[model samples]
Target: LYGLLRRNFRIEEIQLVRPDINLLQKDDGTWNLPITSSDNGAGSSKEAMMLPFIADNVQIIDGNLTWAKVGETTSLSIQNFTIRLKIHSINSFPNMDLNLSVGEMDSTMISPIKDIKANLKTSEGLASLDNLSLNISGGSIEMKGDSTLPSKDKDAEYTATISVKNIDLETLISQFVPEAKELLKGVVDADITIKGQGFDAKADIKFSIPSLLVQDKIKIEQVKGNINYADFDFIISDITMNVFGGNVVGKGTGTLANISNPEFNLAFNVNNIDTGIALTALGQDALLAQGKLSGNINASGNISDIKADGKISSDKLNIKKMGDLTDITAPFRATITKQDKEVNIDNFSAKIYGGSVEGKANIIFGKDGQPHFSTTLNLSGLEAGNALKQLAGKAFLTGKTEGNIQLAGQGTDINTLTGSTDIIFKNGKLATHPIQNLLSVFIPALKTINFVAAKFLSTIGDGKVNITTATLENPQLLMYYGKGQMKLSNQKLAIPSHLLMRCDMVAKMPLVSGAFVREDENWCGIDFNILGTLSNPKSDLGDKLKGQAIGSAIEQIFGGDKDKEDKGGGGIGDLLEGIFK
Candidate 1:
């Protein structure tokens, strides 16, 4: 074969393993073969052996390559470790089928593919590839397509379809958009089609991903959607999603007219959203608690510009916990709009802590991209006990209040929303609670761990709360008239010092009494001072009150003046005597 081809054509590298049976034959029956004449005797029963046209790196496993006369409708078949081909005839172009399997090939240019199998057929001037399966990441993909050969005067046309199942979304994204790897993850499935008229191709895509992560910590239990795309325009619709224990429906359309300055519109509807789940889906760090919400929102714009409008309402929203607050509920509603820079609420209202609150606000983005806010609000018929329940960890203060407020400020984040509030409360009461004991700096009996209060009345103003006049009374225990002021700055609170406070702690038994008075408008504590913050306090409540609190209970419990009659008292009297001596 090598000598015959060299006479008419240039030669290159050639190799063969079975040279022992190499042969050549003439048409007239003469032979040039590496075999004994005994094995190739003329008119003998032995037949000529068939040899392969060897090439680089080929392994023949189970089938043979056939050589037949051209234009004779002859057939041939070949199979090897890497390929299998069958041809019915070869005068010009006849029916042929091919299958190829490669262990390592790069299909998407993203990563090396493994276990790839492709099937192709050429028949009657039409060609097609079908059931071409490939391994992608930890998943698999199958594809099929067809095309026509162009005639001398016409162009080619093509169509293709692909299906993906149980594919890793993270793997696909990491290969194409590594920056978003953390923003999305989970299993993906899709059925897609692409068809063309030579120049402008169109695609129809349908896909689903389950338990995907996005926006850092937010999660969607599942999402399914479809897209229609042509040229620079695309539309997606019939999108459904489950997230944070809620259902979401959405639709949108966008143009790639200018990739850098794209444009689009999106609409979303939410129903019966669980607050706890919603918070998690929104990636909120401050909470994962109770509530339910329903709403609709729409937005339109490009990457550099946007606008939106929406409305949300909660007939009843409950939070089991928020810091110290516990088991609370509110009814809320807001109509919101946003045009590029700011979000504005036109009608805002809520029922909170047994209070009716109404307000309007605007949130604007600053030059530095931080949020700034402006708001005005009014609170009516609010119960102090209910309002303070969460913040104080105890709803001990009982009172009704009405107030008006105006606020303006900016915050770096949620925890740092900074502003000042002015509130004026009237006709509030501290009933039966040891709330007065917390003012032990002024109360005389609490020094002995005793709580003795019946009724209290006051008018309070945040940054202006004053006991301008107070009446604490117990027909059977104690009574007092008091006046004082409280100051607020930063986050700290100060209970006024000096004679601005007064107390007469006796009802039927005149056992103890204290007073606070003012001179030159400077009030002084006739007893002791009190100081503390809303969440924490500084002064000892019982420290100074001890000396003035030798009442009947002290006599019955620790034998105060009653000791004058216990001449042989040893438990506490002897110890006190020894200390004095």
Candidate 2:
């Protein structure tokens, strides 16, 4: 009988159950429920409907089924189920209204959803679902939607909207990002709309959050944004947030579909923010102090085409770097652009230590995808004592200093860095030195001058250092003047330079009121020369004076052979020899 009924029409094995049923369709004839058709054929088949067990309307009421099929596949099943069906003609589908519940749904392989309630209604050519609800790991959500029937080549059309409230982001983020969710605290509210036909779909969503904290170190007061998503492109707008007691505003559009050729442009502005807390919050720890920062910047494009231009300023700002605190009260400007995988810094200018510093740089990516950088810097107007203290944490000299520095290297760690620098100082005091060790080359008065003060000027460049016009005087010892040059390579020191100086010996007390010599003898200044390296330099006051004497004698000897070459050189040499004598 079942084989005959399935030849022309798709019929399910009907279980003549009367509710509270938990078994599959019974195989015995006793549980068989016969379905009959009406025959009244002028416009419709007119015939009295007769069910096998006898009487009434052509429908099933308070009926239960363990399984149902619409086609070849067994697609429906129910428990604690109640359905209303009315079938008038054998050629049309019956009206069906069903209410059912399930323990768990296993349709999604990633995670199982539980406690599903589906209320369905199908009539005419439309279908509607009401009160659809499910539970996820973090929270619960509800959905409502409707759909139209589909034909051969055309797909069903549908519209759906979802609401999410106070979902636990920690739980959600841990499943995806697998980082700490406990160090964070926040609540999320979102509204989502999805509409699709066939294989194409679009989504519009909005989010609002308040009082979010990360590791309890940084806090955001409010955040609001919206996104329009289609395919792989997104348009974001009206983004606003608060951090470090300042406001941040931004907007942009981008496409991540093609990673090699991304396009983006975002203009951002920040106002009167605390630099220390802001830097800390952004994962930097330079220990900035006593400054408020405000700036506007534009960031865009992929790595090969990235660019940035901005101006930043601070008032009386102090930064802790390399275990020293440096102060600055100046404005900074920077412009950067990238081309052919090389990043270029067109200009970077700032002021420090009552001076100005300016430079340019280039960064190229290596085979390992790390940056290799080369840069040049020029510094001026910096105090000698301050610059020394900033670089070495100790001040040995005091005056004004200027310098040029060049650097080139790769890697992110400072330990793997390399560079070279040059410096010059003028009119400074030597706070401390090894002057006593240099008594062989300098006068005894150098100790007293080093103890109190001195005048000095020096210039260094290209691995070579020169010192000129360093003078010292003392009544107890003698007056000394000096100049020299030195060189360095790979931090190894070598000096091959010359120095010319004069020393004055003072005669005082007048023998305690007894007697004395001439006025020139009271403070006899001598001519001298210094030779050799900074490590072991040699002085020759006797030789320099003797040379002057010989040169003078030779000049007199050649007075008859006077060529235009001497001009006043010989005259000046004669005057110096007479004064020294």
Candidate 3:
């Protein structure tokens, strides 16, 4: 009968169960049964021979049977005919009152079961399976009350309440992402419970499938966890996950739709989590830093669309062969939303370096599974020079540099960032090191000016520059454009004595402090324009004694009866070329 039923009904599995019904009789002689299985099978050989069994009147109330196809079962011949079965049940059971239904079923080798229900035994706590109704067309199976044992111990008493209302955890998840159910098959567990209006339940749900072939792409090992969802709250505890040796423990809750929005309060602490191994678990690359990081994150958000606020700090992050000993501590707040074909980040802000970076970003997936996104960052009061050195191991400037930048970008990929920024520098100085070669040769004689003072005011005059763009493209600036002024002071030019003799002029001597010095008091002032590129500037200095020399030379050339005239000091040439003429 077992082999005939396994072949006829297409039952692919079967198991024989031993009875575990212990009945206790009361002393009242009324046979008050604590628990009992009423025997309806053949009582004895003599009684079985006396009564002719009628098949129409006899029906097995609570029963169980396991049926499975053996080896070499081809798809064409592996239909309902290939299933082999063996029956198992409490031989006899007394049902005072009974109501049962098939809750779910596993998928068949060929057809998918959309919905299923089975009769349950609630009398002796043995939970005998009665009948099963399955929808084998779609890949959805739902079994009712005590269909599958909590553990491999078949005789264990089942005491869990079962209530399911519109429950399709896998189906719901598949709607959002068809592969989500497959990805989370072993990565996550969905424990569902429905409790309201004087009803409650608790169930241990497991999605921890070791060696779970995800979409037949990658094989994961030691992925296991348990979830408890009941009474308007859900929690997952004692979660020991595996990814090159790591663990995660937390509790989460929300409405019971796998892909639907669910708010969850989570807390997790990681230990020795190999970033490379962890990222590989999620199908991503791991960029390692200086030291290992260990911290706990407290976040609350929905499953599909979540709002998380947490803080993660590191001792020192190593960016491989670069400078180290850098510490970053930041608090981030962000809201994640999911659309029909994409995910979005709204109001994402984090305090990084010395400034607050705020922005909104999004990732849109096309039909071909390609993701594109755009992000705009508003960074205020950032110390750019210091940040650049920390992130890239090179400084953009050296001396007291500080600024604010407003940047924006859009791209399909996150690696190759494309953006524009408007940066403003105040009292910022590019230290005199990188550009020392270019600037040192210009003022070779002016050795005292070791540092260029780009200030609001100068000792010569008011000095300032409005640098439109200070871009550093390695050894060259893409565009250098600015305007500034270099003022000249009212100081006398100390010319060499050899250059003075070429003038052929003289001036009256002015006696002061017991020393006589040539004085040209009328021609003491000279002015010049200072403007141009940093490499060169416009300037000119005129000789002050030229006027006196011209007058003296003409008189000497036209002399006929020149009187003994003291035109101020001695002869025409002498007077004209005196210290003061």
Query: Which candidate tops TM-score?
Result: 1
Best by lDDT: 1
The sequence of per-residue lDDT tens digits that candidate 2 reaches over residues 1-581 is 74454444433333343554333333331222434333345655433332222112222334434543223343234333333333222323333454445554432122335455666655665557776766555556677777665645578777778777766655554444333346456777778887777546677879777778755557887878887767767787767789887877877777757643556777777677787776566444537354576666676764344565555554445655322223322222233332224556556565666576677777765445456777787777767677656644556566666777777665443433456556556555554433222332224444323323344455545555455455554344444566655553332223222222222322322111111122343444444455544334445543443354444444565455355345654443454454333
Ranking by lDDT: 1, 2, 3
In candidate 3, where is summed lDDT lowest over 10 consecutive residues? 496-505
Clash counts for the predictions, in order: 7, 7, 35
Candidates 1 and 2 compared: the better one by lDDT is 1
lDDT against the true structure, per candidate, is: 0.55, 0.52, 0.37
Consecutive 10-residue window with the lowest summed lDDT within model 1: 506-515
lDDT of 2 at 33: 42
Pick by TM-score: 1 or 3, better one: 1
Candidate 1 segments exceeding 4 Å error: 1-96, 107-109, 150-155, 255-264, 278-288, 299-309, 320-348, 358-378, 393-400, 403-418, 433-494, 497-528, 531-581
In model 2, where do residues sit more than 4 Å from their true spots? 1-103, 106-112, 166-187, 209-221, 243-247, 255-267, 271-275, 278-316, 321-346, 360-376, 385-400, 406-417, 426-501, 504-581
Q: Kindly list the per-residue Cα lDDT of model 1 for residues 1-581, writing each as its tens digit.
A: 54453242322333332222223344535455432234455566554232323222232233223333333433322222145555443322334576767555433336556676888877776669876998777788899999775554556677889999888876776665444455456888899998875657788989998778753456887799998878878898768899767788989998867654557787888777787775544434325346667778677875345677777666666544422222222222222222225777766677766777677788775445455777776777767677666655565455665666556555424233334344444445553344354444334454332113322233433444444444443333333444454443433545543322222332211222322232223222344434565545344324433334444554466555455556665544453334222
Ranking by TM-score: 1, 2, 3
Q: Estimate the overall C-alpha local distance difference test score of candidate 2.
A: 0.52
Candidate 3's C-alpha runs over 4 A off are 1-179, 187-200, 204-226, 229-233, 240-247, 254-265, 270-307, 318-325, 334-397, 410-435, 442-467, 471-581
